[model samples]
Target: MWSLALLFGLVVCTLSVPTGRNSPAFAIEETAEWIRYEGYVAETHNVVTHDGYILEVHRIPYGRFQTASTAKRPVVFLMHGLMAASNCYILLGPQNSLAYNYADAGFDVWLGNARGNKLSRRHEELDPDNQKRDFFDFSFEEIGKYDVAQMIDYVLEYTGSEQLHYVGHSQGGTAFLVLASSLPEYNAKFASVNLLAGVGYQNYFPSLPLRTLARLTNTIYASAVALGLVEVAAPSFFRRGDDDSIINAVPEDEYLSELSTITELLRDGADDSDNSNMFGGAALKQIAHFGQNIRDKTFRRWDYGLLENRRVYGSVSPPVYDLSLITSNVTMHYTVSDVLLDERDVLAMVNDLPNARARKVAREDFSHLDFVAALDAKELLTDYIIESTVQIENLRSTGK
Candidate 1:
């Protein structure tokens, strides 16, 4: 799910992509409203980052059968991946959706939407549509650093909860790592963390077209910067513009169609074919950040070139995230068939963190999207995570 295909699909599919492969998918009417329609209690909380971006986080305070409470149950904060909104959690309905299941299991569920997505696009200062260049200048560094940090602080303060149980999929997981590693103080804020197809350590990306697209995006971004057109959407860059520097390089290989996962990819939480809110939007800088990781094979901060890097980071290059700083217990679950994030990449990330481990998805044929959208995800993955969280809570309660 954390590939250039998804970046393009999320950033362009709904706007200017051709009809067949990269077309837009169905978007949910409203996340909270949809949850309420399903006989569940839903709440919306708007959190402002330190940098002025406002994020919309959804909450399922209790189960359909249980009463809503002020006393506070165990809190589970579920964050979505790149180009996805918090709605991805409940898209499969109450039965298969992880958010609904967690709520049903007596846990307070908080759904987080990253900045640049539809639900969280508002900011205190710059208007996204009016000031496109400045509004879109940030990358995931700001996300993991300012956005995730403020959101976590807000969630804890709002619920009066001391700690949270975190579950981050793809870029969400990367955000967690960014927060934990960069700001180690936040590590103890999470009781447990589960990363589904954890998207850091991209040294072993398996998809060729995805790799090609990453390079192409990087090239286009550089060219755009040189041409004073910094904020680029995939539609503008991928289209056959007269500037052939980045145009004629679109991957048209026959096997490229085999990577039809783009069809399932979400943009603005609407790509689910059977009435879903799984797709979401992203910024061009966010896409380029991941693309840089794909090309350089380093999970470092976004590169700002030599002069700007020294000015912004006080170094010649971006510093790598120190995984060793993440002292909280983290379990990374990877599906064997995930085309974008290889198992080895997940394992390598696991090896870096002192308190991290890797768990392969039980389903052999599980793809990247299956971690969230699979029909049997509860049985295959979330069930185990829920059970594990239960055991952890029980141990804490018993002081064992």
Candidate 2:
């Protein structure tokens, strides 16, 4: 039995889902184009991590472009944010995205899926079907230290490069900070780090409705876990499918209806001619880190109950990491419109890094997902950043 206060709070969460009308209409043509663009021919190579977890590595051909070969182009390891997969860089609806852009620009691209995601769900001797084969014994801390460190080593070994560059979006960015703090030896292996819409300081942004819900829900989640309703923490989106929202303590059918309502909000008034879902379960989890980033201010980590619960919590998020000793050459990018992570909080993380700087995107109305989701990323964002990054790398190289 649920209390009225808890029920009402859940209602508030559903009602507040932002409508699609608020955003500029997504272009159907662009969506079609994105659907058609060629992704790198990826080869799967599995690596066993120090902790006995297995990670799936997708290696895109490095020599497809001449620029990468001629310049001895540096290898870049790409890590997706929370529940997302490596596919995110490929599906931005026709606008040339970073995944393609970096490959086109001659850098060897390797997109990493965090452990427990659909693609990276593997352990050495454990069967996923076994009841024991659920989302357990994992958190972002494991990702940052063991998963990332191993992937970094694998990329260097695969590319035969002594050093590599890194780019992490949202939680991906946070993971590297964790890596730096715990496995500082890996720092020497990376040349630079590009943090897109990162999270480290929670106090820097304005209070949003979702942030408030997170505070409430975090407590609810703690209680739910205690009561053995651990699945409530997983994000409801997985079950909702094309629906609007999830019903707390309700049947799947009713929850599906609410999910439909939320979907309407996400797809409001768009040319019904063009209804495209550019994100997947893995990708959504990747981005949810923006919220978790806020909830776990100052490096506290979260358990993975929210991600594992199939019925209740589709948004089972990983724990927050303590980043007190993250000392890396890091550059953070922020746009005025990124509602998920405000510029102030991103900058505060920049301030914390031993060697860090901040870059503000010229436009304001950008949301957090736009860093990778927007169709115009290559033209509007990454190219500029890459050009400047290369120049900066050059200057540092000469100085050294």
Q: Which candidate tops TM-score?
A: 1
Q: Model 2: C-alpha RMSD to truth?
A: 8.0
Q: Which model scores highest in lDDT? A: 1
Query: Which sections of candidate 1 miss by over 4 Å?
Result: 1-29, 224-278
lDDT of 1 by residue, 174-278 (tens): 889989999999998999999988688889887777777777666656554443444432222232235422231234322223333443332222332333334
Model 2, global lDDT: 0.56
Instruction: Give the alpha carbon lDDT tens digit for every residue of 106-158 in model 2.
Output: 66778776666556666787553352214434455678878888898888987
Number of clashes recorded per candidate = 11, 42
User: What TM-score would each prediction reach against the true structure?
Assistant: 0.84, 0.71
**RMSD values, in order shown:** 6.4, 8.0
TM-score of 1: 0.84
